[model samples]
Target: MATTALPAPKSGSAVTVRRILAIIGVGFLVFFAFIEIVPFVLTVANSFKCLPAVQAAPQAFIPLPPFGISCQTETGSVRSATEMTDGIAFNPTTEGYQEVLRQNLGKWFVNTAVFAIWVTVLRLLFDSLAGYALARIKFPGNRLLFFIMLGTMMIPGVVLLIPRFIILKQLGMLNTYQGFILTLAADAFGVFLMKQFFESIPGEIEEAAQVDGASRLTMFFRIVLPMATPALTALAIFSFQGTWNNFMDALIILGGNPDLFNLPLGLALLRGAYGDTLRWHTFLAGSVITTLPLAIIFFVFQRYFVEGVSYSGLKG
Candidate 1:
């Protein structure tokens, strides 16, 4: 007697497993997105709420009506609702923003901008020159000099704080914008980065230029630098960001002079003055303002950032 043929295993199981995995991946993405966005959302929400509402219901993103509802304080006493509106959940308030502006936030912004721009530009020029000389120019003890520069990179920046301060004081540069700008302009990393990029470029390009009667300066400016646009752009972005976000350097160098303060220093001062009573909305507003320029620069020159990372052998 012929046995009944067994049915083949269903192929649908494999497809079902893949679908489940895809769903799980999408779920993970959604979760991370929420995590990233929650702080900004909370900040925006709380910013609109009156001070009392924010303190009363710190976790409550939505503004609840005054309905005689009250919250207990540390003193175990119930306090009446002071300020809140039920119209919009998260409305924008210019109070915090206005305070920032009133306190010369514009000046801090300008200070940061000027420092970032000058440092970036000067670093590009000087670093490229030094890098080129080290990479191609044959001179006595060139290797030793390159090694010395590299060694400086290994030294912790914090360790140099006192020494740098002393030198600046000796030069009478403390509390001056020139001091801040010039110190950052002379960057070792920039030189090292440019040197690596220059090394990767074929020597044949420079040799050919020299063959055509181009002077060394002409070859560097016209031929080498032009081709190094990708590396240069990357360096510029890095230098700008470093100078803009720099806190300790600014604090140590600029001291207590609010007039010379950068955004970071100013924000720190705000936090110190406000402390626990600091308005979250104002803090967030200041954060938004401070972050805007870097965001713009990064987005605009994003291509260069990518090239710089990948081509310069620098990891994120």
Candidate 2:
């Protein structure tokens, strides 16, 4: 005799529930996207707007009219007309950007580039070396040293500004590139990140290299470093971003020297904050310029950045 067939499983409700959840999740994502991207879009838009337009309609995504229209006169002279229209016009101007460029932002860009590049390179080198030693080397006080370095991270960075200033003054490094470059060259977070990453790497790889008669330095530079690309990329991105956007330290150190000012200090100098009047247009233009490098760096190395964070925590 044949047995009765089992009832078919019903998945319609389950599928419907999943679809509902997916729609809700997608809605939340869209909301967050608007929240983050709208400001940048407005900034880019306003950076091309005239000062009057910016001040008149600061919160508007589109600049309100009375737009300036240039017409060639019969004698070959150009005259501007203010057009007030009902609909939104696409009459864009570059006054804010022109103001920023006229302020000699190129020199500030170069100074920022130099400061950020050197800080990132040196931090990566010094932090990676210290991290690798702490992770791989067998020595007395190694743990103590690591703990001391980690403990320093807990102290507020602002608290050290005065002390750092005094030391730089005593050393005659104030208002010098050395002061900014050396101040941020090595940091505790980088050391911690790299050490955790190095710890996650297996010891067998290093041992195998050693067995092949490779020296310690060779093993580290050639063998291990290649494997730590993700961590290094993350560290480089962080270091570059931190150094590039460092406003307070730049203010404290390079504030007195306009010739040595970076983008942050330059932007600060552009602000007109006497009794509530401000220059938002020029400030936003400078901000847009300053944000480009960080955006590029993050977009390029975002993959490694995620992986590095994952591996750093895996062993710790």
Candidate 3:
């Protein structure tokens, strides 16, 4: 019988190496997920528990009680061991929510919303306009202007604090909404982002519009701007988040007026006045309320925001 040479034995080492790598990758992902998820889970769980329960034993998963807190059992309601011990009962209370609201959370919410909306809208318009002009319009010092704008972005934002404050003071805009909104309404990064997105659109589209007797302004507003929705959406979301979370600038510009405090400023005020003895539940509740709008906005527009970031490669 002709002994056909049997194929060389497969390298078991290679298969073993791949298995090790696969195991490592899975382990890393599980570890990373655990790290990321634990805090959010803890926050949600703690939000449901009463102050004493959280303080007494924050690590506890089930609500302990004299408060009679228990989830529905398979055979109707069942009291947990925790429920029987504490004469206090476990139940969801809106006291935290009520306290946040009663403490002028509504005003802070409205202030943040207004600031974010105005800054976003204005930044979108101005940045896109400047970007389009820099990208497409030929004018004296155009390149220089673009370079200056780019250079401005490189300057640390913290460095601008004193200078910006001085300028605002000189301009008599201190403590005004205009001061806060306009301070960040035309960011260099936003302009740069818009410029890059505008550049990505083939010049052919704008040329065709021009050939059809469309004015530059008309083509930009009606044609280019409409098609740049992804970038604009991303810029808007960024602007909103930045303005909403703005604390230092608002604090410095608006002074210590409680009436003028934004969400972050207001939150900080709670801690400053009450110190560590402050109601942890109330503070967390306010945080939850403050975060909800941004979370909703992000989820709703996440696709566009992600697309814009990917396409722009802003850092790169």
Candidate 4:
């Protein structure tokens, strides 16, 4: 039997198809990026604006009068922010920042920072340890335990709120920083994430450490842990951002005490003023402050975040 020869497609047509796909992909990316970024740009712009300016035209981003400079007339009388807020170029003010600072925002800032930092540290240490054990340890029911943990992640976090509240109440940890910290320190997702990353590491390295008379703890801390920086950094970012931005948990735990509120809860408190005088500027200023640290952390260590996510996806 004779087989007919198949002709390959022309190179020019293939190149044209590739170019069209690339252009379409780039267009979609740009469209989505704009959608995601516009809100952030508006938020940042509005944070610098006075209340009237923000309220009058929240979409305005450009500054007419120099930023941090008061809007004024030739007669030297101050102008209402609304006067220039209709246009793209509006007067920018530091009043929002000042008012926020004047509030008990300092205490909230400290509380948020403490919660985020402590939780991140604990998660990195505890999660990595748990993950490493689940990945490498040959104990009985290890897979069972790992699967059980993954099961917890499937349950809605809100479903656990009542139970968590009850547990904290029984432990007399409600409204206490220590209780809140301990409650958030170890989570199933972190364990699973770290476990996945740890499994991707070569076992030969740990064996070499053991052969050199290193204890399991020493080998983990000195050898394996160092190699898992990407995952650790990613975990740190996630833990800190989650803890820092957490409203429901913080509200449930610390709602009884305004003095102990984190930034999110505290910002929510700022909305209680009368309808006409809600202080939108102050609220926006607080929001910006809340987002700044997380943004900075993500920008600084974003490379590691990507690597950690990629490493965690690798299956043995």
Return the top candidate by TM-score. Answer: 3
Indicate the worst ten consecutive residues by lDDT in candidate 2.
78-87
For candidate 1, lDDT tens digit of each residue in 1-316?
Answer: 1222345435788557766877898899999999998876666565544345554543446544443232344576533234343434332345557666887889999998998899989999999999988988899998898899989989998998898798989999999999988888868788888888798899998899899999999999998999988778888888989999998888888965899999999999878988777776567667878988887888898888777768656532
Best by lDDT: 4
In model 2, pairs of residues that clash are none
lDDT of 4 by residue, 1-316 (tens): 0111346545777767766877898899999999999988888888887666776644789866555765455677655666657667776788778889888898999999999899999988999999999999899999999999888888997887899899999999999998789999998888988887787778997888788899999888988888987778778877888999999888888988888899999888667643556777777888899889889988898887676656556632
Worst lDDT run of 10 residues, candidate 1, spans: 1-10
TM-score of 1: 0.80
**Model 4: which residue pairs collide?**
none
How many pairs of residues in model 2 come into backbone collision? 0
Off by over 4 Å in 4: 1-29, 57-59, 64-67, 70-78, 82-86, 272-277, 307-316
Q: Can you give the lDDT of residue 48 in candidate 4?
A: 82
| RMSD in Å for all candidates | 7.9, 6.3, 7.2, 5.2
Query: Candidate 3 at 62: error in angstroms?
Result: 6.8
- Model 3, which residues run further than 4 Å from truth? 1-10, 58-90, 312-315
- Give each model a TM-score: 0.80, 0.81, 0.85, 0.83
Which parts of model 1 have CA positions greater than 4 angstroms off?
A: 1-26, 44-88, 310-316
- Model 3 C-alpha RMSD vs. true structure (Å) is 7.2
